[model samples]
Target: MQVKKADGSDYEPNTISAFQRSIQRYLEEKSNLSILKDKEFDSSRTAIAAKRKSLVQSGKGNKPHATKFLTYEDEEALFSSGQFRDHNPEVLQRTLWWYMSLHIGFHARDERHKLC
Candidate 1:
Protein backbone atom coordinates (compact mmCIF):
# COMPACT_ATOMS: atom_id res chain seq x y z
CA MET A 1 0.00 0.00 0.00
CA GLN A 2 1.07 3.54 -0.63
CA VAL A 3 0.17 6.70 1.24
CA LYS A 4 -0.09 10.04 -0.45
CA LYS A 5 1.57 13.02 1.17
CA ALA A 6 0.05 16.48 1.08
CA ASP A 7 2.19 17.23 -1.93
CA GLY A 8 0.58 14.35 -3.89
CA SER A 9 3.71 12.21 -3.70
CA ASP A 10 3.12 8.62 -2.67
CA TYR A 11 4.87 7.67 0.51
CA GLU A 12 5.57 3.98 0.79
CA PRO A 13 3.56 1.89 3.22
CA ASN A 14 6.49 1.61 5.60
CA THR A 15 6.97 5.32 5.89
CA ILE A 16 7.46 5.23 9.63
CA SER A 17 10.54 3.07 9.32
CA ALA A 18 11.70 5.07 6.34
CA PHE A 19 11.34 8.29 8.28
CA GLN A 20 13.21 6.78 11.22
CA ARG A 21 16.04 5.72 8.95
CA SER A 22 16.15 9.16 7.40
CA ILE A 23 16.47 10.73 10.83
CA GLN A 24 19.29 8.37 11.76
CA ARG A 25 21.11 9.09 8.52
CA TYR A 26 20.77 12.81 9.06
CA LEU A 27 22.16 12.48 12.59
CA GLU A 28 25.12 10.53 11.26
CA GLU A 29 25.78 13.20 8.63
CA LYS A 30 25.60 15.89 11.29
CA SER A 31 28.07 13.97 13.43
CA ASN A 32 30.46 13.67 10.51
CA LEU A 33 30.21 17.40 9.84
CA SER A 34 30.96 18.09 13.49
CA ILE A 35 34.05 15.89 13.25
CA LEU A 36 35.20 17.84 10.22
CA LYS A 37 34.72 21.05 12.14
CA ASP A 38 36.77 19.72 15.03
CA LYS A 39 39.57 18.68 12.70
CA GLU A 40 39.68 22.12 11.12
CA PHE A 41 39.75 23.70 14.56
CA ASP A 42 42.58 21.40 15.63
CA SER A 43 44.64 22.25 12.57
CA SER A 44 44.29 25.95 13.26
CA ARG A 45 45.22 25.34 16.87
CA THR A 46 48.36 23.47 15.84
CA ALA A 47 49.43 26.29 13.56
CA ILE A 48 48.93 28.85 16.31
CA ALA A 49 50.83 26.65 18.75
CA ALA A 50 53.79 26.40 16.37
CA LYS A 51 53.90 30.16 15.87
CA ARG A 52 53.67 30.82 19.58
CA LYS A 53 56.42 28.37 20.37
CA SER A 54 58.71 29.89 17.76
CA LEU A 55 58.13 33.41 19.08
CA VAL A 56 58.67 32.43 22.73
CA GLN A 57 61.81 30.40 22.06
CA SER A 58 63.32 33.40 20.22
CA GLY A 59 63.22 35.63 23.35
CA LYS A 60 60.31 37.71 22.05
CA GLY A 61 57.86 36.46 24.65
CA ASN A 62 57.56 39.79 26.43
CA LYS A 63 56.25 41.67 23.42
CA PRO A 64 52.73 43.14 23.22
CA HIS A 65 49.96 40.53 22.72
CA ALA A 66 52.39 37.95 24.02
CA THR A 67 49.80 36.70 26.48
CA LYS A 68 47.71 35.60 23.53
CA PHE A 69 50.32 32.96 22.86
CA LEU A 70 51.26 32.08 26.42
CA THR A 71 48.70 29.34 27.10
CA TYR A 72 47.41 28.83 23.55
CA GLU A 73 44.39 30.93 24.47
CA ASP A 74 44.18 32.42 21.02
CA GLU A 75 43.27 29.02 19.60
CA GLU A 76 40.51 28.57 22.15
CA ALA A 77 39.14 32.01 21.30
CA LEU A 78 39.24 31.40 17.55
CA PHE A 79 37.58 28.00 17.88
CA SER A 80 34.69 29.59 19.70
CA SER A 81 34.36 32.27 17.03
CA GLY A 82 31.38 31.92 14.67
CA GLN A 83 33.42 31.12 11.61
CA PHE A 84 31.80 27.79 10.58
CA ARG A 85 28.21 28.30 11.63
CA ASP A 86 26.76 27.75 8.17
CA HIS A 87 27.53 24.06 7.72
CA ASN A 88 24.30 22.40 8.89
CA PRO A 89 22.78 20.94 5.73
CA GLU A 90 20.87 18.07 7.32
CA VAL A 91 19.05 20.14 9.89
CA LEU A 92 16.08 20.81 7.65
CA GLN A 93 15.93 17.20 6.48
CA ARG A 94 15.94 15.92 10.03
CA THR A 95 13.28 18.39 11.06
CA LEU A 96 11.03 17.47 8.19
CA TRP A 97 11.30 13.74 8.90
CA TRP A 98 10.66 14.31 12.59
CA TYR A 99 7.55 16.33 11.88
CA MET A 100 6.28 13.85 9.33
CA SER A 101 6.74 10.95 11.71
CA LEU A 102 4.85 12.77 14.43
CA HIS A 103 2.03 13.65 12.11
CA ILE A 104 1.74 10.12 10.74
CA GLY A 105 1.81 8.53 14.18
CA PHE A 106 -0.76 10.94 15.55
CA HIS A 107 -3.14 10.36 12.67
CA ALA A 108 -2.76 6.61 12.96
CA ARG A 109 -3.59 6.70 16.65
CA ASP A 110 -6.54 8.99 16.07
CA GLU A 111 -7.95 6.65 13.47
CA ARG A 112 -7.59 3.68 15.77
CA HIS A 113 -9.32 5.61 18.55
CA LYS A 114 -12.21 6.53 16.30
CA LEU A 115 -12.77 2.87 15.44
CA CYS A 116 -12.63 1.76 19.09
Candidate 2:
Protein backbone atom coordinates (compact mmCIF):
# COMPACT_ATOMS: atom_id res chain seq x y z
CA MET A 1 0.00 0.00 0.00
CA GLN A 2 1.03 3.60 -0.65
CA VAL A 3 1.14 6.00 2.27
CA LYS A 4 2.56 9.37 3.22
CA LYS A 5 6.30 9.50 3.67
CA ALA A 6 7.66 9.24 7.18
CA ASP A 7 9.23 12.68 6.79
CA GLY A 8 5.73 14.09 6.04
CA SER A 9 6.85 15.80 2.85
CA ASP A 10 5.16 13.74 0.18
CA TYR A 11 3.59 10.40 -0.73
CA GLU A 12 5.80 7.30 -0.70
CA PRO A 13 5.67 3.58 -1.25
CA ASN A 14 5.01 1.56 1.87
CA THR A 15 3.59 -1.76 2.94
CA ILE A 16 1.97 -3.29 6.03
CA SER A 17 4.02 -6.47 5.69
CA ALA A 18 6.17 -5.83 8.74
CA PHE A 19 3.12 -5.45 11.02
CA GLN A 20 1.44 -8.47 9.52
CA ARG A 21 4.52 -10.61 10.05
CA SER A 22 4.74 -9.65 13.70
CA ILE A 23 1.12 -10.58 14.32
CA GLN A 24 1.53 -13.86 12.51
CA ARG A 25 4.51 -14.73 14.67
CA TYR A 26 2.57 -13.90 17.83
CA LEU A 27 -0.39 -16.09 16.83
CA GLU A 28 1.90 -18.96 15.98
CA GLU A 29 3.60 -18.74 19.34
CA LYS A 30 0.26 -18.84 21.16
CA SER A 31 -1.66 -21.24 18.99
CA ASN A 32 -2.51 -23.49 21.94
CA LEU A 33 -4.65 -20.85 23.61
CA SER A 34 -8.42 -21.31 23.13
CA ILE A 35 -10.05 -17.94 22.48
CA LEU A 36 -13.57 -19.29 23.07
CA LYS A 37 -12.90 -21.02 26.38
CA ASP A 38 -11.78 -17.94 28.36
CA LYS A 39 -12.93 -14.47 27.41
CA GLU A 40 -10.90 -12.56 30.01
CA PHE A 41 -7.68 -14.44 29.45
CA ASP A 42 -7.87 -14.32 25.66
CA SER A 43 -8.72 -10.62 25.57
CA SER A 44 -5.89 -9.70 27.88
CA ARG A 45 -3.39 -11.86 26.02
CA THR A 46 -4.42 -10.48 22.66
CA ALA A 47 -4.16 -6.92 23.93
CA ILE A 48 -0.64 -7.43 25.17
CA ALA A 49 0.40 -9.15 21.96
CA ALA A 50 -1.00 -6.35 19.83
CA LYS A 51 0.78 -3.77 21.96
CA ARG A 52 4.11 -5.59 21.59
CA LYS A 53 3.66 -5.95 17.84
CA SER A 54 2.79 -2.28 17.53
CA LEU A 55 5.89 -1.29 19.45
CA VAL A 56 8.10 -3.46 17.22
CA GLN A 57 6.55 -2.26 13.97
CA SER A 58 6.93 1.29 15.10
CA GLY A 59 10.42 2.71 15.86
CA LYS A 60 9.59 2.74 19.59
CA GLY A 61 10.59 -0.88 20.18
CA ASN A 62 13.07 -2.07 22.84
CA LYS A 63 16.05 -2.11 20.50
CA PRO A 64 19.19 -0.03 20.05
CA HIS A 65 18.98 3.53 18.73
CA ALA A 66 19.94 3.93 15.08
CA THR A 67 21.29 7.47 15.07
CA LYS A 68 23.52 9.23 17.63
CA PHE A 69 25.58 6.11 18.26
CA LEU A 70 29.04 6.83 19.61
CA THR A 71 32.12 6.38 17.48
CA TYR A 72 35.75 5.57 18.44
CA GLU A 73 36.82 9.18 17.91
CA ASP A 74 34.11 10.51 20.20
CA GLU A 75 35.00 8.02 22.91
CA GLU A 76 38.69 8.83 22.71
CA ALA A 77 38.05 12.57 22.80
CA LEU A 78 35.88 12.24 25.88
CA PHE A 79 38.39 10.15 27.79
CA SER A 80 41.55 11.93 26.68
CA SER A 81 40.57 15.37 27.96
CA GLY A 82 42.97 16.83 30.56
CA GLN A 83 40.13 18.34 32.64
CA PHE A 84 38.52 14.93 33.16
CA ARG A 85 41.88 13.39 34.08
CA ASP A 86 42.61 16.10 36.66
CA HIS A 87 39.56 15.16 38.74
CA ASN A 88 40.21 11.43 38.63
CA PRO A 89 43.66 9.86 38.98
CA GLU A 90 42.24 6.54 37.84
CA VAL A 91 42.34 7.62 34.21
CA LEU A 92 42.52 4.15 32.69
CA GLN A 93 39.78 2.82 34.96
CA ARG A 94 37.38 5.62 34.12
CA THR A 95 38.18 5.40 30.44
CA LEU A 96 37.31 1.71 30.40
CA TRP A 97 34.16 2.41 32.41
CA TRP A 98 32.98 4.99 29.92
CA TYR A 99 33.78 2.72 27.02
CA MET A 100 31.72 -0.14 28.44
CA SER A 101 28.88 2.18 29.40
CA LEU A 102 28.65 3.59 25.91
CA HIS A 103 28.84 0.13 24.38
CA ILE A 104 25.97 -1.20 26.49
CA GLY A 105 23.76 1.84 25.88
CA PHE A 106 23.02 4.57 28.45
CA HIS A 107 20.39 4.42 31.16
CA ALA A 108 19.76 8.17 31.27
CA ARG A 109 17.40 9.71 28.76
CA ASP A 110 18.71 13.24 29.30
CA GLU A 111 20.93 15.41 31.52
CA ARG A 112 18.34 15.52 34.32
CA HIS A 113 18.75 11.80 35.05
CA LYS A 114 22.46 11.73 34.23
CA LEU A 115 23.90 11.86 37.76
CA CYS A 116 21.19 9.64 39.15
Candidate 3:
Protein backbone atom coordinates (compact mmCIF):
# COMPACT_ATOMS: atom_id res chain seq x y z
CA MET A 1 0.00 0.00 0.00
CA GLN A 2 1.83 3.04 -1.27
CA VAL A 3 0.36 6.09 0.41
CA LYS A 4 1.21 9.47 -1.07
CA LYS A 5 0.84 13.11 -0.14
CA ALA A 6 -1.48 15.60 -1.81
CA ASP A 7 1.34 16.58 -4.15
CA GLY A 8 1.86 12.92 -5.16
CA SER A 9 5.03 12.67 -3.13
CA ASP A 10 5.70 9.77 -0.80
CA TYR A 11 4.62 9.87 2.81
CA GLU A 12 7.09 9.68 5.65
CA PRO A 13 7.71 6.31 7.31
CA ASN A 14 5.91 7.32 10.50
CA THR A 15 2.91 8.51 8.50
CA ILE A 16 2.89 5.28 6.49
CA SER A 17 2.98 3.33 9.73
CA ALA A 18 0.00 5.31 11.01
CA PHE A 19 -1.90 4.64 7.78
CA GLN A 20 -1.07 0.96 8.01
CA ARG A 21 -2.39 0.80 11.57
CA SER A 22 -5.60 2.54 10.56
CA ILE A 23 -6.12 0.10 7.70
CA GLN A 24 -5.36 -2.81 9.97
CA ARG A 25 -7.92 -1.53 12.45
CA TYR A 26 -10.58 -1.20 9.72
CA LEU A 27 -9.88 -4.70 8.45
CA GLU A 28 -10.18 -6.14 11.96
CA GLU A 29 -13.47 -4.31 12.54
CA LYS A 30 -15.14 -5.26 9.24
CA SER A 31 -13.62 -8.63 8.29
CA ASN A 32 -12.18 -10.09 11.51
CA LEU A 33 -8.81 -10.44 9.72
CA SER A 34 -5.45 -9.49 11.21
CA ILE A 35 -3.13 -8.11 8.56
CA LEU A 36 -0.23 -8.04 10.97
CA LYS A 37 -0.54 -11.74 11.75
CA ASP A 38 -2.50 -13.42 8.93
CA LYS A 39 -0.56 -15.47 6.40
CA GLU A 40 -2.33 -14.04 3.37
CA PHE A 41 -0.72 -10.63 3.94
CA ASP A 42 2.84 -11.81 4.63
CA SER A 43 4.22 -10.24 1.46
CA SER A 44 2.32 -7.03 2.14
CA ARG A 45 3.56 -6.90 5.73
CA THR A 46 7.14 -7.47 4.59
CA ALA A 47 6.85 -4.78 1.90
CA ILE A 48 5.57 -2.23 4.39
CA ALA A 49 8.28 -3.15 6.88
CA ALA A 50 11.02 -2.90 4.27
CA LYS A 51 9.68 0.38 2.97
CA ARG A 52 9.53 1.83 6.48
CA LYS A 53 13.07 0.71 7.20
CA SER A 54 14.35 2.25 3.98
CA LEU A 55 12.54 5.53 4.62
CA VAL A 56 13.87 5.68 8.15
CA GLN A 57 17.40 5.00 6.97
CA SER A 58 17.02 7.88 4.50
CA GLY A 59 15.94 10.21 7.40
CA LYS A 60 12.27 10.41 6.45
CA GLY A 61 11.11 9.26 9.87
CA ASN A 62 10.12 11.29 12.91
CA LYS A 63 12.63 13.85 14.18
CA PRO A 64 12.67 15.54 17.58
CA HIS A 65 12.51 19.33 17.75
CA ALA A 66 14.02 21.54 20.38
CA THR A 67 11.67 22.03 23.31
CA LYS A 68 10.91 25.49 24.64
CA PHE A 69 10.25 26.41 28.27
CA LEU A 70 10.16 29.53 30.40
CA THR A 71 13.55 30.32 31.83
CA TYR A 72 14.18 31.90 35.25
CA GLU A 73 14.82 35.25 33.61
CA ASP A 74 11.64 34.94 31.60
CA GLU A 75 9.68 34.19 34.75
CA GLU A 76 11.28 37.18 36.45
CA ALA A 77 10.35 39.37 33.49
CA LEU A 78 6.71 38.19 33.65
CA PHE A 79 6.64 38.88 37.39
CA SER A 80 8.20 42.33 36.88
CA SER A 81 5.58 43.10 34.18
CA GLY A 82 2.82 42.75 36.78
CA GLN A 83 0.96 40.18 34.67
CA PHE A 84 0.90 37.72 37.56
CA ARG A 85 -1.18 40.05 39.72
CA ASP A 86 -4.71 38.93 40.64
CA HIS A 87 -6.19 42.42 41.00
CA ASN A 88 -7.21 42.80 37.35
CA PRO A 89 -9.36 40.21 35.57
CA GLU A 90 -7.08 39.84 32.54
CA VAL A 91 -3.96 39.62 34.64
CA LEU A 92 -5.69 37.19 36.98
CA GLN A 93 -6.62 34.93 34.10
CA ARG A 94 -3.06 34.95 32.80
CA THR A 95 -1.78 34.31 36.28
CA LEU A 96 -4.13 31.39 36.65
CA TRP A 97 -3.00 30.01 33.31
CA TRP A 98 0.64 30.23 34.29
CA TYR A 99 -0.02 28.57 37.64
CA MET A 100 -2.14 25.83 36.14
CA SER A 101 0.51 25.14 33.47
CA LEU A 102 3.15 24.79 36.13
CA HIS A 103 1.14 22.88 38.73
CA ILE A 104 -1.49 20.89 36.83
CA GLY A 105 0.35 20.19 33.56
CA PHE A 106 -1.87 22.50 31.49
CA HIS A 107 0.43 23.33 28.60
CA ALA A 108 -0.36 25.54 25.64
CA ARG A 109 -1.14 22.51 23.49
CA ASP A 110 -3.76 21.19 25.90
CA GLU A 111 -7.34 21.47 24.60
CA ARG A 112 -9.35 24.25 26.26
CA HIS A 113 -12.36 21.92 26.61
CA LYS A 114 -10.32 19.65 28.86
CA LEU A 115 -10.27 22.37 31.50
CA CYS A 116 -14.00 22.14 31.93
Candidate 4:
Protein backbone atom coordinates (compact mmCIF):
# COMPACT_ATOMS: atom_id res chain seq x y z
CA MET A 1 0.00 0.00 0.00
CA GLN A 2 2.94 2.35 0.54
CA VAL A 3 4.40 1.73 -2.91
CA LYS A 4 3.46 3.81 -5.94
CA LYS A 5 4.23 3.83 -9.65
CA ALA A 6 7.24 5.73 -11.05
CA ASP A 7 4.94 8.59 -11.92
CA GLY A 8 3.83 8.78 -8.28
CA SER A 9 0.40 7.34 -9.04
CA ASP A 10 -1.14 4.43 -7.18
CA TYR A 11 -0.70 0.91 -8.40
CA GLU A 12 -3.69 -0.73 -10.05
CA PRO A 13 -5.83 -3.03 -7.94
CA ASN A 14 -4.67 -6.09 -9.85
CA THR A 15 -1.03 -5.23 -9.19
CA ILE A 16 -1.77 -4.59 -5.54
CA SER A 17 -3.59 -7.90 -5.29
CA ALA A 18 -0.62 -9.67 -6.86
CA PHE A 19 1.65 -8.00 -4.31
CA GLN A 20 -0.64 -9.23 -1.56
CA ARG A 21 -0.50 -12.77 -2.89
CA SER A 22 3.29 -12.61 -3.09
CA ILE A 23 3.49 -11.40 0.49
CA GLN A 24 1.19 -14.18 1.62
CA ARG A 25 3.30 -16.74 -0.20
CA TYR A 26 6.51 -15.38 1.26
CA LEU A 27 5.11 -15.37 4.76
CA GLU A 28 3.83 -18.92 4.37
CA GLU A 29 7.16 -20.19 3.03
CA LYS A 30 9.29 -18.46 5.63
CA SER A 31 7.03 -18.55 8.64
CA ASN A 32 3.99 -20.24 10.15
CA LEU A 33 1.50 -17.49 9.33
CA SER A 34 -0.96 -17.75 6.44
CA ILE A 35 -2.53 -14.46 5.52
CA LEU A 36 -5.30 -16.15 3.54
CA LYS A 37 -6.41 -18.67 6.15
CA ASP A 38 -5.26 -17.23 9.48
CA LYS A 39 -7.91 -15.65 11.64
CA GLU A 40 -5.42 -13.02 12.74
CA PHE A 41 -5.16 -11.79 9.14
CA ASP A 42 -8.90 -11.24 8.76
CA SER A 43 -8.63 -7.49 9.24
CA SER A 44 -5.76 -7.28 6.75
CA ARG A 45 -7.76 -9.26 4.20
CA THR A 46 -10.77 -7.01 4.69
CA ALA A 47 -8.60 -3.93 4.20
CA ILE A 48 -7.20 -5.31 0.97
CA ALA A 49 -10.65 -6.17 -0.31
CA ALA A 50 -11.92 -2.70 0.50
CA LYS A 51 -8.96 -1.11 -1.25
CA ARG A 52 -9.59 -3.21 -4.36
CA LYS A 53 -13.25 -2.22 -4.38
CA SER A 54 -12.34 1.43 -4.01
CA LEU A 55 -9.83 1.23 -6.88
CA VAL A 56 -12.39 -0.49 -9.14
CA GLN A 57 -15.01 2.14 -8.34
CA SER A 58 -12.50 4.79 -9.40
CA GLY A 59 -12.15 3.06 -12.86
CA LYS A 60 -8.94 1.18 -12.14
CA GLY A 61 -8.27 -2.56 -12.73
CA ASN A 62 -11.05 -3.02 -15.29
CA LYS A 63 -10.54 -5.48 -18.14
CA PRO A 64 -9.41 -4.09 -21.46
CA HIS A 65 -12.02 -3.68 -24.20
CA ALA A 66 -12.49 -6.76 -26.32
CA THR A 67 -10.82 -6.66 -29.73
CA LYS A 68 -13.41 -6.81 -32.50
CA PHE A 69 -12.98 -9.50 -35.13
CA LEU A 70 -13.85 -9.08 -38.78
CA THR A 71 -17.08 -10.75 -39.96
CA TYR A 72 -16.96 -12.92 -43.09
CA GLU A 73 -18.80 -10.20 -45.01
CA ASP A 74 -16.34 -7.60 -43.80
CA GLU A 75 -13.42 -9.74 -44.90
CA GLU A 76 -15.03 -10.23 -48.28
CA ALA A 77 -15.60 -6.49 -48.63
CA LEU A 78 -11.95 -5.79 -47.80
CA PHE A 79 -10.82 -8.34 -50.36
CA SER A 80 -13.15 -6.84 -52.96
CA SER A 81 -11.84 -3.37 -52.15
CA GLY A 82 -8.33 -4.47 -53.21
CA GLN A 83 -6.94 -3.98 -49.73
CA PHE A 84 -6.06 -7.65 -49.47
CA ARG A 85 -5.29 -8.20 -53.15
CA ASP A 86 -2.95 -10.91 -54.38
CA HIS A 87 -1.89 -8.85 -57.38
CA ASN A 88 -0.31 -6.08 -55.29
CA PRO A 89 2.85 -7.31 -53.60
CA GLU A 90 2.79 -4.61 -50.88
CA VAL A 91 -0.88 -5.21 -50.08
CA LEU A 92 -0.38 -8.96 -50.07
CA GLN A 93 2.56 -8.69 -47.68
CA ARG A 94 0.59 -6.44 -45.34
CA THR A 95 -2.43 -8.75 -45.45
CA LEU A 96 -0.24 -11.77 -44.73
CA TRP A 97 1.47 -10.02 -41.82
CA TRP A 98 -1.88 -9.00 -40.32
CA TYR A 99 -3.41 -12.47 -40.62
CA MET A 100 -0.24 -14.17 -39.39
CA SER A 101 -0.07 -11.91 -36.34
CA LEU A 102 -3.71 -12.64 -35.48
CA HIS A 103 -3.21 -16.36 -35.97
CA ILE A 104 -0.10 -16.34 -33.77
CA GLY A 105 -1.91 -14.39 -31.03
CA PHE A 106 0.60 -11.55 -31.06
CA HIS A 107 -0.54 -8.46 -29.24
CA ALA A 108 0.56 -5.33 -31.09
CA ARG A 109 1.91 -3.52 -28.06
CA ASP A 110 3.43 -6.52 -26.27
CA GLU A 111 4.92 -8.37 -29.28
CA ARG A 112 5.70 -5.65 -31.78
CA HIS A 113 9.28 -5.16 -30.60
CA LYS A 114 10.02 -8.90 -30.61
CA LEU A 115 8.53 -9.30 -34.10
CA CYS A 116 10.45 -6.32 -35.43
lDDT, candidate 4, 1-116, per-residue tens: 35678998877898888988899889988999988889998998888888888889988887666578889999889889888877879998878877878688876776856875
User: How close is every model to the real structure, measured as TM-score?
Assistant: 0.22, 0.34, 0.63, 0.59
Off by over 4 Å in 1: 1-37, 63-116
Candidates in order have lDDT scores of 0.48, 0.52, 0.80, 0.83
Q: Which candidate should be chosen as best, given lDDT against the real structure?
A: 4
Clashing pairs in 4: none
lDDT of 1 at 69: 23
Task: Report the lDDT of model 4 for residue 107.
Answer: 60
Model 1 agreement with the true structure over 1-116: per-residue lDDT tens digits: 23347997543323433554565578677775432235655664454456545545655445453222224564345335632233465644544544455466545557645633
84-109 per-residue lDDT for model 3 (tens digits):
87889989988887787678775455
Candidate 2 error regions (>4 Å): 1-40, 64-70, 83-93, 96-116
Note the residue pairs that clash in candidate 1: none
Let me know the TM-score candidate 1 reaches against the reference structure: 0.22
Best by TM-score: 3
Candidate 3 collision pairs = none
Query: How many Å off is the CA of 30 in candidate 2?
Result: 25
Error of 2 at 25 (Å): 26
Each model's total of backbone clashes: 0, 0, 0, 0
lDDT of 2 by residue, 5-78 (tens): 47753221122334445665676698854333456466645655565566466644443534576677875677
TM-score of 4: 0.59
